[model samples]
Target: MDIRQYIDSTYLKTPAMAGTTIKENNEVVRSLVNEAVANGYKLVMVRPEMVAFVKRLLCVEKSKVLIGTVIDFPEGEGMLFKKLDEANKSIYDGADELDFVIDYKAFKRRDFEKVKTDVIECTRLCLDHKKIAKWIIEVAALSDKEIISITALVKNVVLTYFSESDYFNVFVKSSTGFYKTESGKPNGATIHSVKLMLENSFPLPVKAAGGIRNYEDAVQMIRLGVKRIGTSSASEIIAGEQVSDEY
Candidate 1:
C-alpha cells in the first residue's frame, strides 16, 4: 500500500507542571491546535488539562481534528484508578479518543492479570464516556518476549473491549520521545516491538512512533505493517521532507 495515505499521529507533550507557569499549558495547547489545524493535521495527542481547550480550538468543519489525550504517559506506572480518573476527565473535557500507557513493571513481573484489569478499567472509563481507547504499550521498555506477551494481553483486552465498548486500539508505540542519545534513532527494541505488533496482530492497526524524523522512515514503517505513524515531525512529513527521490 502507498504510505502517503497513512495518517501522522502526534502529541502536544507539554510538561505536566506547565500549569504552574503564568501562560499555562492551555494557552500553548490552543495555539498549537490552531496551527496544526491550519496546517491540515487531523489527530493530536494532548494532556488532560488541555483537552477541552484543544477540542474547542480545533473543532471546525474545515479542521475536523480529533484529540487523543494520554492517561499516564511516558511511564504507565501510575495507579490504575488515578489513570482512569484522568481518562474520565479527559473524555468529559471533550477528547475524541484516549491513549493510555500500560505499566511496564507489571508486564516485566509477568503480571498479565493486573495489566488486563488496568486496561479493562481504562477501557471501561472510555466506554462510559463514549470515547475511543488506544492502549499505548510503551514498547521501548519490554524485551522481545515481553513485547509479544504484552501484545497478546492487549489483543485480549481489545477483543473484550470491542465486544463491550465502541472501539479498541492496539497501537504499540515506539517511545515517548523522552529517552534519547547522541544517535537520536528510535531504539532497536522499539523497532522489534513494532515488527512484532504488526506480525502478531494482523487485523489490528499498529501505530509506529518515536524517532520518525522523515517521510521515508514513515513510508518504510507502513511497509513494515504500521497503519499510523506518530511523530513530532508531522509538518516535515506532510511537507514531503521525509520522502525519498523515488517518491
Candidate 2:
C-alpha cells in the first residue's frame, strides 16, 4: 500500500503548548506542513486558526497536500451554533477537510435528537461547501453499545442527506487523541472500537485516529479498510520506526 497517501500528517497543538505567540505556533505548523509536502502525505491537519497560514505556505511552495482542521475539538459539548461558526471560519480559511467532534455526552444522555441535529448541521455545511466532513466519536469515552449506536446514527444521517457519489467526502473518525480518561485506560483508537465503527458506519469511510503510533499499526488499520490514519508521528511511521509521540 502507498502508506503516505493513507496518512494525514498531523499537528494540532494549541498555542500554549507550541508557544504563547501566533508566530511561534505558525513555526511549528510550518514545519509540519513542510514535512507533509516533502513526503507527499495526504493532508496536513492543524487548528482552524492555522489553516490560512498552511494554505498560504503551500500555495507559495507549490505543494499539493490538503489542509484539514478540527471543530469543537477534544470536547464535543460546545454549543451547536458556536461549532458551526468555527467550522465556517475554518472553511473560509481554506481548510479542505473538517473533523468535527460529535457531542457524545448528549448521545450518552439518550438525547438522540440533539445529537442528530448537531451532526446534520455541521455535515450539511461541509457538503454544501464541497469539503470532506469527518465525525470524531472519541471512542475511548464511549461504551461498546454507545459506539455502535453513534456510528449507526452518523451513517443514517449521511445516507439520508447525501448520495453515494458523496460518500467519500464523509467519514466516522475514531478520536481526538486528547480526551481525558481514567487511570490505566487507553484514550484513543483501539482495534475493537475501530471494528465497531467500520461495521456500523460502512458505506461511509472510516478514519482511525489517536494511539496509532507505528508503521505496523497503521498498516493494520489500512488493511481493515480505514481510509485515513491521523497521527503526529507520520514521519516515523513512514520510516518504519516506533513513534514516541502520544498523538
Candidate 3:
C-alpha cells in the first residue's frame, strides 16, 4: 500500500482539511488553520469569512499559501447570483479554489438543465477570479440511475464550463454534516460510488469526502483513484488515528 509514487510531493507538504461549515466562528477557524500551518499542513478548506485571515497568515512568503472555501455550501438553496457573488468575494479574500454543492433538490427533481446551468455559472465565477471550481455531487444520496444521469450531465457541464483545464473536477461527497436524519451518522465515502464513477470514465477528478478519518481509509480512497480527499479529521489522520475528522 505504499503510495510514494502516486503521492504528489506537494500533497504531503500541504494536506487539505475541509472545515465544513459556513457558520462556524471566525476566531476558531483561524486558530485551527494557524495551528495546521505551523504543524506543516499547507492547505485549509475554510468558510468564506476565514479565508482572508488564513490568507494573511499563510501568504507570508509571497508564495500565497493555497486556500479553498465552499460555494453554494452544504445546502444549495441560494440564488445563482448570490452563489456567484459569494464565490467572487471568497476569491478576492484569497481563496484559491471553490467547492460548490450542486443543488440536490433540483437534481432530485430531475432538473438536469438547471443543475448544468448552476455548474456553468459557478465555474465562470471561479475562473473570473482565477480560482479552480470543484463541483460536489453528493453522490451518496443518488440512486444508481441518478448517479449515472448526474455523471453524464456533469461531464457535459465540465466540457462546457471551461476549456483551460482539460478535465474539470466533481467531488463525490457523502453528507454535509447536517441533514443526516436518515443515515444517523455522517454519510461515509463508498467504494461503490467510486467504482461507478471510474467505470463511467469521466475526465474530471473525484474527491472522496464525508467519513474518511485515518490513513487507511485515505489510502483506500487513493487506491480507488480518488485524487483528493475531504475530511475534517485531517489533523487526526496525519496523527495516525482511525476515526472521523468531523470534530
Give the top-scoring candidate (TM-score).
2
Error of model 1, residue 161, in angstroms: 5.4
The backbone clash count of each candidate, in order, is: 2, 0, 1
After superposing candidate 2 on the true structure, give the runs of residues whose Cα lies further than 4 Å from its correct spot. Answer: 19-21
**Each candidate's TM vs. the true structure?**
0.82, 0.97, 0.81
In order, candidate lDDTs are 0.66, 0.91, 0.64
Give the clash count for model 1.
2
> What tens-digit string does per-residue lDDT give for candidate 2 at 38-156?
99999999988889989999999998899999999878899999999999999999999999999999999999998899988999999999999999999998999999999999999
Write one digit per residue (lDDT tens) for candidate 3, span 1-247: 5432222111101113334443345555655665555554445677776678778877663443467787777778678888988988988898887778878789998776778888888877766666677776676677767766776677677676567364643443333544353745346456787667655536777766666667787798887787766666665675677874342
Weakest 10 consecutive residues of candidate 2 by summed lDDT = 17-26
Cα misplacement distance, residue 39 of candidate 1 (Å): 3.5
**Pairs with backbone N, CA or C atoms under 3 Å apart (clashes), candidate 1:** 215-242, 216-242
Model 1 C-alpha lDDT per residue in residues 16-78, reported as the tens digit of each score: 534445356556666666656666565777767777766776665446777877778767888
Model 3 CA deviation exceeding 4 Å by range? 1-24, 39-42, 61-64, 164-175, 181-186, 245-247
